[model samples]
Target: MEKRYRLRKNLEFRKVYNNGKNFWNRNLVLYIRKNDLEETRLGLTITKKVGNAVVRNKIRRRLKEIYRLNLYRVKDGYDLIIIPKKNVVDISYKELESALIHILKISGMLKG
Candidate 1:
């Protein structure tokens, strides 16, 4: 994702977590809140419980790619935080994309 679309600040992530509506599936959890800007922002969280450094980074990259691919379809002006479950490490890219899209759709984050 682009620099402008990435949510990098701790306060921003915390704000989204505290105020946003959340949705979850077997592999992913999504937290979304409205933002004032015209573009959407994305944050990702892959905890240590998921894996070692290499594994965690891999998971993070996969999630970011999934989001990047689907970015155009998602609604604008929202802050989104995605938390992937440990099971995500075992899943294929297609499955990861599917799970992420499914959760986004159900959460009303994806535009029709």
Candidate 2:
């Protein structure tokens, strides 16, 4: 993902958590807030409770790739944060993508 499309600051994440509307499924939680920008940005959160550093990084990379591939299908002008649950480590990549897409669709962030 490009730098402009990634949420990197602590403040950014907090703003989304505090102000954004939330959506979730069995595997992931999604928080979304409008940014008034032309593109959507994303952040991913995977706590140590989920796994060790290697596992966390693997999940992060997978999430990023999923988001990157689906970027075009998502609506613009929103800041999105995705938090994975502990059981996420046990699921396959296709399941992870489906869970993310489920929340996005229900949240009205998925653009056809």
Candidate 3:
């Protein structure tokens, strides 16, 4: 995703973690906090426990692509952090996308 649409700073992630409302599925956890900006930003966290660098990067790439594809469907003005669970390593792209969309709907972040 573009740099402008990504949450890159540690402080930014921490703020969202501390203040955001969260939603999750078996595969992913989403932390969402409203932001003052007109655009939404995204962050992804995949801990070492999830896998090696290659594996974690793969998941990150997939999640970013999914978010990019569905960007138009999401509401703006929020900071979104997605944390993938261990089980996510085995899922296909389609399943991951659906899981994310499910959590987004549950969080009421998806625009109609």
For candidate 2, write residues 47-109 as lDDT tens digits. Answer: 999999999999999999999999999999999999999999999999999998888999999
* Model 1 per-residue lDDT tens digits across residues 1-112: 6899999999999999999999999999999999999999999988999999999999999889888888899999999999999899899999999999899989998887
Ranked candidates (lDDT, high to low): 3, 2, 1
Q: Ten consecutive residues with minimal summed lDDT in candidate 3? A: 19-28
- Give the TM-score ranking, best first: 3, 1, 2
Report clash pairs, candidate 2.
none
Clashing pairs in 1: none
C-alpha-based local distance difference test score of model 1: 0.93
Which candidate gets the maximum lDDT versus the true structure? 3
Per-model TM against the reference: 0.97, 0.97, 0.98
- Model 2, residue 109: distance off in Å is 0.5
RMSD after CA superposition, every candidate: 0.6, 0.7, 0.6
Q: How accurate is candidate 2 locally (lDDT)?
A: 0.94
Candidate 1 vs. true structure, TM-score? 0.97
For candidate 3, lDDT tens digit of each residue in 1-112? 7799999999999999999999888999999999999999999999999999999999999999999999999999999999999999999999999999999999999998
Model 2 clashing-pair count: 0
Q: What is the Cα-based lDDT of residue 30 in candidate 2?
A: 93
Is 2 or 3 the stronger prediction by TM-score?
A: 3
Each prediction's whole-model lDDT (CA): 0.93, 0.94, 0.96
As a TM-score, model 2 comes out at 0.97
